[model samples]
Target chain A: MIPVEYMSVILMIVFGFVGMARKFPRELGATVAYTAMLFALAVFGERLGRIVYGLLYRGNPEAAPDLALVQWFVILAFIGAWVVMVYAGQTLSFAGKWPPNAVTGLVFDMLIGLFNGWIVVWTAWQYTHRLGYPQQALGWFVPPLSERASRWVALAPLELIPDGQEPWVLGGFLAFLVFLRVVR
Target chain B: MILSLQHELNKLAFAVLRPVLGGPNPAITPPTGASTGAGVGIDGQVVATAIPMLGADLSAATLVLVGLAAAIGFVRGVRREAITLMVAAAASLIVGWMWPAVASLVNRLWRMFHFAVIERGILAENPMAAWGEAQASAPLLPLGGDAAAWQIGFFVFGLLILGYGATRYVAAPPPKARGIRGFSVLLERVVGAMVGALTGILVSRFVLPRLVPNAQVALLGPGTSLYDRLAPYAPTTILGIVLLLILFGVTGIGGGKPRQKMYQ
Candidate 1:
């Protein structure tokens, strides 16, 4: 199999180009906003899912659907939130008084896009490699699930510079590219 | 100061990372052996547990608040005000760094002053008894706790100052007056940079330390001494300023003339 880390790097590079081509700070801003939202979901999503399950089932664990169903709901919610945030960001960027100018906005979008793209890839890698699935992965905050989940997601795929540092390298390169574009 | 900062950072890190690292679990679950309490989880095991009421996990709440703030800042075009805000933020970090000593000194002075008054008053014959009585009575000042509280208070105060400064600068009358416009813009930039710097420092001190614990000591420097911690953040402060300058230099920092298209 192609190294997962390499796959992430390739994903980041491709995303970087997409970001540059979009060339709107709002697009970058939207990505950041989405990332933040995703982070919130990752931290709280599972709990929310359980709460919904509890309220619906009313203390009857058997009344709830299988674990996979709950996991799918959480995953779908995450995707929904991402879509909403991106759309909201795009709308606000046009409606609001940010980015000041087109060129600056484009640069801002490009840089943020690069950073965000890396974050997505990293999170995905963590999901596939660390946690078996999105629900179990994000549910790691809870002790019971974490104990069970650790067996599957504990080991990181071996990489050249540790999976954590990939974004910085990718972002820095993207920033350099923007700087060159501006100065040139 | 370092210890307190570390404590706060640990809390923040656990809040942010636990969910990401650990799988789905209840926000606050009682320890395996305990009926109720606060505790720290290490590697999937609860290591320390305390009063259940105090054990409420605030990480999710904090994350939400931070996310809101970040969204607002980005939406408000706060980056446009980066230069001035960075400077202010840097200054705030230095103040936060020195706050422990300042708080200690103030505490000493207050105690001495209180004792002096007690000694000279009607309770002069039994000062210790009078001090005890005073302790029993409601405090004259509502202030409570140690340097950590004061440090947090100062951090909030700095944010308020920055917020107010930014609002005033942005709301200033257009440069219709002779030389006033140029001066106003200059002041706005300064204030904006200061706000950005203060926000940066707050993030560094509270959020960054936990997210990147290893980078924390490096950013704050070696040793527990205030100078050591304060000196390292200076680069972060300087970098904020430099970033603002570069941002403006390239973007041409809005030359006072209104653009024809608002969303270009």
Candidate 2:
């Protein structure tokens, strides 16, 4: 039996490849494959947890998780970031009459990604367990901007604030690169 | 702000599903008409953690299978890639649900293969260890009852929406182009394999050990730490990345184009 984490990724790759092989040969196929794998894993995640949980409890299937706000935020963030990155890449790289340099496009998107990272980390800091902790750890500036703003809801509830998942963003950008490489 | 948010949502849907609709080499040319609802933000919460908290059961293999099936239509003279993908997605979803074990088996085999090639020193260090940290910290959902049902329903719905939207909005490529198909296929596999192998080593050597120390338990148990227990497995991980690259590269070349048949 393989370890669960590996199982998850492998599952992703297999489904991803299969999806790619099918009708949607591009990123869409990979996305569906990824989605499918994620769905399957979501279903069996707890069952896999039995590797850890079985020692203590009988591991009833009933004990799973409710979609928490944090979880939702993360999911939305990944999908959002992925989409933004790809679109941005497409717009900058291909939207105009002339195609931009692929390298330039890649760099341009990386900068945008960095900007996004800054914003997410900054936003996350306002509500993190320790307000300035995550920021200081990363060495960034976060002025009150407004003392009154601090008193008010930072933007929304902590859960509601988008947490800017970076991997998905990067994935989108890379997907663009992959797409470009394939099409060009 | 609200408008921007909506726009982002539209983009997210498009970004996430674009790959499914377009294939690796999506047509870059603008669509003939302006498609409505162009949001771009994916719900980060879905895939942030090692485990998908919400709907995300389809494995990479299943994803690939769906793509291949969809591709088969294109190869057979199907013009509407979107519809082909949509059908393939549905078919693959059912197939994946029915044979979860098969998905799991494929995952294991790939991991093993990924570990093998990397261990031989073909690429940077494999990062299977990072997977541990990724898993340890990866997001988890708290869906109490009916994990299967909830996940299945969500998966189907998302795919359907994606299918409908893609078919409706995206345009097909102009005429048959020679060599483009062959070129894109090779590129996708090579890139996928390279990224997989390099990341595998990085995770094992640097990321995993730090984030999720090797031990018998997460906090405290008879053993030291989760990482410690996993230390032995590090070498095995390196091997997997290499093998994964080889396998994907080989398989990619063998895999043909998508079917061109559109909405039949």
Candidate 3:
């Protein structure tokens, strides 16, 4: 009932804009409009999430027990992706051209978008399934000897998550690629 | 962020309203920067929505009227036109603050006396019901209250960004470099003020309603509110140079002259 998949639909639009922005930065007035829309969308998503949770669980998930963990991961994941998508999409759109030629550019953009979408969905699923449990303790979940611990704990994988706005920079790069393609 | 935003809003209110109160109009010369006014009515709505909010408070209201009066004062600065500005500002302040309720009442009266005319139009069958429904669908946020404050914050942030941008890309040497004379300077200022006023009217009447329809809900005539304001809003044929100078290009109209003496 929460319609967790709603996030996917939003991503689709974000990527769609990225694809379009590559070809039409000035015409679309997209660089700013898209960013503004994404910001507005984030607020809307939170409100929608609350509404969905209220309808599904008959109570606000933010205030409920055993649901807080799910809420945290789900909400954070959505926010993280939401921000990243804008940065990524904008980069791709603004660049407005493809490498070497149009065919190569379009193909490369589609491939990157596809992969980005996959990674986002996969990470979301992991969070939804494993981290979704409300009572699951954080640090103890992975044993010291276990593979999860060695990679996630010992390697400290979360550190690899780039700092704020880095993804947006990447998004700008992607936009440039699109711009090159469309402008040519 | 909130404090800076609020301060900038206050400053802009001062800049914009200084004209209305019979003050010298320190006109905003538009620059020929990229015309980004294509369809997205953000700027239009931002400026249009600002008026009602400014009118909500006495000081802020005075600032907007003063800004307008400043614009009207043209080459003459605020010092020369104090009396005219005060009367104009006071009148506009009263009108702006009271107009919403007054307009609402008038609209209600029009509906009553002109019921036949109202019904004969597109919504002839159930005009009142449709009007009620439209009112019901108004934005959840209150007009000219907290939402307006948030909007003002955003507007301030935008202006800051725009100001920084202007400093970077749009600043140009004064018209002295272009070799214009006394008559040309006067013409430029007059034309610029007229252009800005026209832009204000067109934006207030059209483009603004579309981008932030709900924000300008109180302004639209009844027939106008039936749909999105964005769809119909279009840029006026403001002269290219004036528009450019207003947004980004600076002509230094007030440059290097002895400040005119205040009216004795």
Largest TM-score belongs to which candidate?
1
TM-score of chain B of each: 0.39, 0.20, 0.26
Q: Please provide the root mean square deviation of candidate 3 (C-alpha atoms, Å).
A: 26.2
Q: Mind giving the per-residue lDDT tens digits that candidate 2 earns over B173-263? A: 3124323455444433343334332222322222112212221111211122333576555434533532333222223222233223212
Q: Model 1: runs farther than 4 Å from truth?
A: A1-184, B1-30, B38-59, B71-76, B79-99, B108-148, B162-249, B253-264
What candidate 3 gets wrong by more than 4 Å, as runs, is A1-63, A70-92, A95-103, A122-158, A162-184, B1-264
List residue ranges in candidate 2 displaced over 4 A.
A1-184, B1-148, B160-185, B188-264
Q: Estimate each model's TM-score.
A: 0.31, 0.19, 0.20
Per-residue lDDT tens digits for candidate 3, residues A1-184, read 2233444445645555454333322212223333343334333534644554566667544565444554645455564766456554544222222221232233223333433443344334333333443424664232223343223321111122233533453354335434443543
Candidate 1's displacement at residue B32, Å, is 1.6
Instruction: Compare the candidates by DockQ and give the number of the best one.
Output: 1
Give the Å error, residue B113, model 3. Answer: 99
Model 1, A1-184: lDDT tens digits are: 3444455568767667766554443343444454455445445545666666667777777776655456456555665567555654443232223445453344444555555565555554454433344344455332343442343233221122234544553354346435533442
Q: How close is candidate 3 to the true structure, as a TM-score?
A: 0.20
Q: What is the lDDT, from 0 to 100, of the residue A184 in candidate 3?
A: 33
Give the alpha-carbon lDDT of every model.
0.46, 0.34, 0.37
For all predictions in the order shown, the interface RMSD in Å is 11.3, 17.0, 25.6
Better of 2 and 3 by lDDT: 3
lDDT of 2 by residue, A113-161 (tens): 3322332333333334223323333334344334443432332222232
Preferred candidate (DockQ higher): 1 or 3: 1
